[model samples]
Target chain A: MRGYAEDKDAYLKRLRRVEGQIRGLQRMIDEDEYCIDVLTQVGAVTKALQAVSLGLLEDHLEHCVAEALAEGGEVADEKLREANQAIARLVRS
Target chain B: MRGYAEDKDAYLKRLRRVEGQIRGLQRMIDEDEYCIDVLTQVGAVTKALQAVSLGLLEDHLEHCVAEALAEGGEVADEKLREANQAIARLVRS
Candidate 1:
């Protein structure tokens, strides 16, 4: 959903890189790599994943949220609530 | 930064609603709206803002991060470190 399938190639590429980074991290863990080095890799992975989440969220807002707003009713309010909860989760996390 | 200035209208619109939601939440607090009602609204606003963050993060990875990776050197490693730090912040938050 959320139009992600439409951009499968690009998404998959990014995800693959992320997956590689994850494996690298696993190796670091197994090898007892320096804590700072491992943590640094972790931070990169986090940002990368966050980037994907953000893309999906933006697309949802621009398309779905905008459409709901255009309809003009409880939809706007409802979408607003949805958006708020999402932000909260991001911030909370 | 982060290309947000390019889409001023759209970003502003989303931000405005988010701002309004924030104000509404403040009012709810002042008026002592039902705790659940206020919290629910808060959640909505949180999700909305997170959407914005996610969008920016995605762009960074696609453009900046990807470019960094392509350079194929210390840049890739450095960008990876940066990405990890960013993700850590997101997750920590």
Candidate 2:
């Protein structure tokens, strides 16, 4: 479970904005918008998504991973392994 | 800048364990550990890290992006652009 519940309305509002951005991008593509402008918008979206992912990742490590590790032994090892793979993915991306 | 200061020690501790897991994986590779086992561990790490990223991303959207949007005009558009690019990157990864 999530250790904390972030503001639902705020979360949804941000997501909604992102959704609009995506649709705009789609429209841009349909209309053949300038390549650079499209790319620039793409970069913005990437950063925003990263920001969101980073928050979740931190919370999970602090709560889920920590709790599992506190339990010790195989669980700890498992959580450690899980974390490492996650980092690898982030780096690869 | 970060809007919040997460627990430093706790964050470091989790990172340290992940670091150890990586080193262990390296050793496993050197020793020709079972391919299946290595892949399994790799998967675990991926999930752990994803959890962390998600937490951070949520916070960024809620705080940074939202604040910028509330400020209005070009700032809102810029934030929206940034966020869209971020989500794109996340999906690609």
**Best by the lDDT measure:** 1
Best by DockQ: 1
Over B59-84, each residue of candidate 2 has an lDDT whose tens digit, in order, gives 55545654664465777567656754
Candidate 1 lDDT over residue span A8-88, tens digit each: 688889999999999999999999999999999999999898888766655555455545554656875586467646644
B1-93: candidate 1 lDDT, tens digit per residue: 553456668878899999888888889999988999998998898778877776665555544654554464787567646754665466456
- lDDT accuracy of residue B78 in candidate 1: 77
**How many Å off is the CA of A33 in candidate 1?**
1.2
Reference-based TM-score, model 2 = 0.47
Q: Tell me the interface RMSD of model 2, in angstroms.
A: 11.1
lDDT of 2 by residue, A1-93 (tens): 673355446556777888999999999999999999999999888777766666555555545655664465787567656754664466457
Stretches of candidate 2 off by over 4 Å are: A7-11, B1-93
Report how closely model 1 matches the true complex, as a DockQ value.
0.07
- DockQ, all candidates in order: 0.07, 0.03
